[model samples]
Target: MRAMARALPSLLLRLLLTSTPGALGTNPGLVARITDKGLEYVAREGSVVLQRELLRITLPDFTGDFKIKPFGRGHFEFHSLSIHSCELRGSALTPLPGQGLSLTISDSFIRVQGEWKVRKAFVLLSPAADSKTRIQARLHGSFDVQVKGITISVNLVLGREPSGRPTVTAPGCSSHIRDVEVDISGDLGWLLNLFHNKIESRFRRVLESKICEMLQNSVTSDLQPYLQTLPVKTKIDSFAGIDYSLMEAPRATAQMLDVMFKGEIFNRDHYSPVSFLAPVMSLPEQYNRMVYFAISDYVFNTASMVYHEAGFLNFSITDDMVPPGSNIRLTTKSFRPFVPRLARLYPNMNLELQGAMASAPFLNFSPGNLSLTPLMEIEAFVLLPSSAKEPVFQLVVATNISAMLTFNTSKITGFLKPGKIQVELKESKVGVFNVELLEALLNYYILNTLYPKVNGKLAEGFPLPLLKDIRLYDPVLEIHKDFLFLGTNLQYVRA
Candidate 1:
């Protein structure tokens, strides 16, 4: 039994290692959830579109011939059929499992008015003479049409295009017209009333058919093209660009829609994938907000890697870069107390600190906390009387920083505060000196100099991938293990 148990453990390990990629293995850097509230918001916007488009419907002009019992045959023609007004009473959008979205519109009404013309033929017979036919005068007037209790149902199939953009298509669309009332008035209004059944039936069929046709056209032509215009790849700066491409078709459920994105950063001039893959990330089950956005640490790390590879992490700090009115200055005279050799070798000369990141910075997220670690090397130099620089010493600085992240409508910003700092002298041309003596000076320089510059740049923040004319409102951000969660509602503003 013991031998069999050992063999089973080995088999299980092999199975786990060879498992196919599934929900637990798929790691998307960015995820977005649109809840029922978001669907309702979209439905409200769709109501306006539905109303406008329905009002633009033009029912086909209808012509028919009717027989008057024992009198004659009359022909009528209705033309210039146009909708005068429309009112939408209710609308809703719902998600379907394994399909897409369902849009339902109910209790809508429209008023249509048109012009009509009728021609009647009357026969008169006398016993003494042959039967004679008399043609009555042509009658023309206006008619009013009222179509109420209108309902429209459409299915929007969400998909992805070849270029990684989202697509919307209404493959199945149908409309229900509950009631259509037609009123005819003219100099022979009573005659037109005799054929009311035919007129009303024709009107109902035309309205129902035209309404669905207009809706299908609007979805395919307007909504689909608009979705294709989404910015999938946007430049973050001159050096790097961010990829917000959809990974696959969105997953639709009864309550929400889930979309995954390849939130990777690449070099703008020369595109290359980051070395690491994104870790699996999941969002909370709460749906209090209209929408929720989840971002993984891989997104930020890729950005760091891109910028570092572009050589942007190297910088030179001079005395002038120091904050104004600060006691700490980047001069050999100021460093004399910490390093006596620096003062003796380069006396009264201005100092410069050239720093380069040893590697890309790393960001870690835990529950309610975010931490950043960066390792860099700094070389001290003194400006000679002839404007040349002489190396004094080199030190490697490692820092742990805690960041407080905040987001606005367009961007995510962070404020990094230093937590623990470590410094070591890597090389010394002046002479060997106690590194501990320079700790306080380095701390002051970092706090008053390096941090301020970094914080200033961070305050500018990075842009978020959002659609045009859409903004987040009432947003709340939370930090989770290996990811960040943002819950908010959306607002559409016309530009």
Candidate 2:
């Protein structure tokens, strides 16, 4: 599982770098939104408090037999010992992706200044108490437990329980315990004073062990299961999967950590020849809080392929669809008023219109406009009343369309808006037949109905690939010769 976890990000990165932009857009860029959630820390003043909270280090009351050759034997029971005040210096944390975290914590000193009472204790070879009698005892001591240089390192790896939730596993924990000085003052004080060196040596070892144990337990209990799955949930409405991968290790600077990534959209149905050979660039440090994207033309081309495969580009204009009072006036020498009626007299006088791209659609991104131009073949066919099935009038019109793009943000998605559509005809069969009839119907349907229908379809904008709970801000967009740049601030959407 750990090896698989390590390899998943690499696989995702390959997909992102290899896939070319298809029907989704000309360019599909990665969405790297980093937040200070899993790996976090406090500094200086607040860190000490955080450390204290994480490891209270409250030792239970222990009663046991204390024996030494020179000091003799005694039954001793000690009261609870706890750390009261501490000086926290600083802390740092680095995340290990799916594994866990590496933590480094510092503290100037931890003052374990608490009262400890030992009762029913007696020492052999001592003048104050008899050897056979387990005399009742009372002792109070103040100990200054100090760590030299006060640097602690811990590595917490994550493991799962039976319930599938994540739990922390402390693989390594190291803390240096420099000195423990005990000032003994109480009944039978001479016995303690005599064995003080041995007592301090034993206490230091125990304290070090307790500190490590307490930290492991505390951190494991406090760690949350937030790094389970990193998903890019958004995609074009028609696209099925995400193509994204980490470009390199996360780059940490003074103020923020930047995760450099690359992504592209893919279409299983549409094959694209474009290649993304550009090297993954370093993250720019200009914006502290930003998401930067660069979209290529392959994404847009793939989306066109998907639309064509789905038969969305094919449309029809029937007799009933023409406005009630509208007329198709032919401009030939024998032009007649009833020609429009005669055109509609067939079982269904309709133009079987089909639009197809002559070449891939070109998407140009600018400050406000996202324009698309697809060289197209718009064919119109009219069926005669006398003909069985085939149309008597067949004409192919070559044209191109331009439109402005708009977009809106939803709870979990952002999609494009296609509006302000304009169609420009490049070539048409005008003088061959009654071209006026075909032209009138094309204008009436293409502008009045087809454009609106296309707009309606476009209102369901392409969903930008992103993660859930993320909110993208207004983007600062820029266009270059080969790519488009989009940068925005991002955050978790507030409930």
In TM-score terms, which candidate is top? Answer: 1
The TM-score values for the models, in the order shown, are 0.88, 0.56
Candidate 2 lDDT: 0.51
Relative to the true structure, how large is the alpha-carbon lDDT of every model? 0.84, 0.51
User: How many residue pairs collide in each prediction?
Assistant: 0, 21
Q: Give the per-residue lDDT digits (tens) of candidate 2, residues 305-362.
A: 5565556666765556667776542222122333443333433344445556565555
